[model samples]
Target: MASVCINEALTDDELRSVLSKLEEERDKEMFGLVCKRWLRLQSTERKRLAARAGPHMLQKMASRFSRLLELDLSQSVSRSFYPGVTDSDLSVVADGFKSLRVLLLQNCKGISDRGLVSIGRGLPSLQSLDISYCRKLTDKGLSAVAEGCQDLRSLHMSGCRFVTDGVLKALSKNCANLEELVLQGCSNITDHGLADLVSGCRRIQHLDLNKCNNVGDDGISKVSQACSYSLKKLKLLDCYKVGDQSILSLAKFCKNLETLIIGGCRDISNDSVISLAIACRNSLKNLRMDWCLNISDSSLSHIFSECRNLEGLDVGCCEEITDAAFQGLGSMETKLPLKFLKISNCPKITVTGLGLLLGKCDSLEYIDVRSCLHVTKLACDEAGLQFPECCKVNFTGSLNEPDLL
Candidate 1:
């Protein structure tokens, strides 16, 4: 049977039902873009229908939206310019998505500061804003939001190279209620900006300053000293300036930390990891330390022995790790709280190292021992796949393990 169009004789409820079904079709964007009537009906009711529309379709849909509690437009990969797409298309997207509780316009290259200003206008209830990787965004555009949207609770400006400490100051002063901030790849930000924000925002729970090379011990010391009470999750990926002192400071003060990611922080040695794990061992749930070459068997052994409650861990490319350290993880008590584990390119991990974990940690649901060259088929079979997740295995020499449909 042919689908009933919204233009036909249909009540609002019937149109909504039809639109809901249309959303499931692969060409849902095309369905919304054919005419103004479809765009109007689809845009206003899109929260339930579509939240991940590509740029052109999103631009079209934004025309008729009057009220929205949240607007998430992150990770739109399509760069193909639709011939019909014009400046008016962008204007609609900016002007319509008003009163948003959360607005994520990350990676939208087409949107300049003008577009940002247009979007920020009249967004009185806007709380969470993620402009991460929007290269065109400048202080002027963001300042407008700081001056206007005072209720913002969380902000993600990662990869926003143009944004500087001025924006941070504005956010620290204006968005006082902010509880989460991600400043990854903002090379211009200094310790002053970081310290000011951390000291000011007492309610912050999660902070990601990954690849923020400028920040050193001075900045991190202030954050550790001040925001320890509420800071739960902190990611400092590739921040080379931060050393063991920062970790020690964090462990001493931020005892409530549940998730800590310190990937590519080469300045840290085994002592820092050991101290951090010891201090926050009882509370730490997820810990990732990828490419931290200085870490060795001693570090892992200490963390495993102490961080007994740890559930998720990733120690990728930590070449210094030795096989003996695996035994501490092997002795993990059952109910076996550890669920997720990733150990890639740790050369010493043969069947012996991995086998210990398989026999002991019965609750492990996700395991990535990829590139551990010595692991054979025999090891996999001996370590039974009784868990709810990742039951598929290649028992034979052939790596052709059939995926369960």
Candidate 2:
């Protein structure tokens, strides 16, 4: 019955209107099969396409969607339904979509330096490229990108372990307009590489160095000095080599930061955190300090007193935080209220302190208190009853896996 209804003849305006409402790729594919006219109309309307098919499908799409602006050939690393795209497949896309602006080849295992070089030479108009998890890519592939795509703005090469200073130098020399660069898990990079990267990309606003173990205080200090003027978001998760000196530099130079994550940077203490609060008080909205066990109530007090606009706060595993920290947050006056709060595994936070803190944060929508030994069922019950119906409290005893901050 559904097929019969869809198969009925419709005018061009009616078909175009119906096609405009279909956004999902699967839905468009199904609609295209309704008739020859529908197939033609779908091809004309398609601008973004995501598929896990191999070379043949890439060739078909290249001809079908003449106006395609973005193409995502990424596939799940765990279980791809079809064979992954290869260098030959990428060459077909490069030849077809010469004006493509965005390309995402994340987790495409078959893609290598040759494929990337082919893409770089063919698609000079590409602006955003995400080759994250493409472990086969190295400096050679990136050098091709630098030589070809000068208008590039955003690039994500996370988990590409072979990347080093050479790749950074090439991109810095060419992609001057680059604003966002994600080097997460690219452990080959050292301080010198980071210094050169930031020096060249003065307009960079967002930088991610999560799990880049070699990037220490010196690298971060150089970043603060060079890109601080435009930098707004910085993530340094699990970079244990970084110390309070790095945070101090960021607090002093990158005062315009809106989001800051320092999870697993255990060397930071109350002094640097306090300075960070005072420096970015008006601009900071989100802060993550999980696993910074040395941070105590004094640091929390300083942050609450100065950074009233803060919306998201994660003090997970901060063993030294006590009731005083919550009280400090309750006393703060600000129009931008806290929306998300996570204090899981904080041994010093008791039921009394948790209740008091909950009563004050009227704007809070999500509260996570897992593994708080002092917080009992009574406290959880009271919290649920007191807060608005819109709020969701997670007081489960078990610890949830850590997520992105």
Candidate 3:
């Protein structure tokens, strides 16, 4: 037939060219289904894959996808019923994917120090690794990765309770090019670990120390000073030991800080907030100060007035914040770029303040005024009806109107 003649006429290189032009995975897969030769070509060209982890499956993948760059074996979601990837499976990965650049094993509970040792010894080209919530991993395993994979750029070890200052020291000494580090809920790490980390890895741009209770002003101040120019996003949520000094240091040193999340740092007062608003006004975009008990109207006023580029603000649970904050926003000569606002659980904010903010900031995409004592459900319903379809407002627990019989 004509189709058979045309397929026979096309060279292997020409077939490969056609395959390269196909962008969709489904289309490429369809091309492979044409014949065994096309299927072989497709397997050779594949670079990334996500699959359920097992020693036999991984070995098969390794042999098929010779040029693979990324592998994701994260058992964080639906794979809870299955026994996750273990040290033996990791050894298969280490032997097969020596050129692998990214490996994500988040919440793979079966993987321990033994598994990581194979990863460290094998994948020297690794640039990003996420072992978050892998509770079995300890400092020994992480340090081995740091020592072996010097080109690492992003490392996320959130909820790895056993990781300590030893891994931090190893990272500082080895992975100088590290940029993004998340140690969220790694409760064992203290100021000493952070100091060791910043001493060498000064290029860190995004750092998360959320729930790191032992990390006080001293550790954060050191980070502010060391990675001042490069630091862009910082999260200090529920770090109760962090007070005004850390914020003040950030304001003074980290002029380019774009996103700051200091929620649950109750000791952060208006003075440091004001300074931060003024200092990082040009660069600061998203800020969350929820549960910051000491910051009030003055801090919010300065923030609204100075931070022209701020796109998100979360000042929830700050009992002192009142209508005065929104009044400042309404009075601005130019409309703020704020698209996300959360003022939930603030008893002092009323319908008047909500109205003022809504009237002025037409760009708002999301607003949460949940549990505001003075704002009625009727008022919220009215505001929702008047606002454009793009904006979403949450007014949960607001006073509902009495129904007529």
Q: Which candidate ranks first by TM-score, i.e. highest? A: 3
Instruction: Select the stronger candidate by TM-score from 1 and 3.
Output: 3
lDDT minimum window of 10 residues, candidate 1: 396-405
* lDDT string, candidate 2, 142-244, tens digits: 8898779999999999999999989889988998999999999999999999988877888888899999999999999999989888989999999999889
User: Between candidates 1 and 2, which one is better according to TM-score?
Assistant: 2
Worst 10 residues of 3 by lDDT: 396-405
TM-score for predicted model 3 compared with the true structure:
0.93
The most accurate candidate by lDDT is 3
Report, for every candidate in turn, its global Cα lDDT versus the true structure. Answer: 0.73, 0.85, 0.89
lDDT of 3 by residue, 341-383 (tens): 8888999988878877777678887777788878756866766
Alpha carbon deviation, residue 150, candidate 3 (Å):
0.7
Compose the digit string of candidate 1's lDDT tens values, residues 276-308. 989997888888887888999888888777887
Q: Which should have the higher lDDT, number 1 or number 3?
A: 3
TM-score of each: 0.76, 0.88, 0.93
Per-prediction backbone clash count? 0, 0, 0
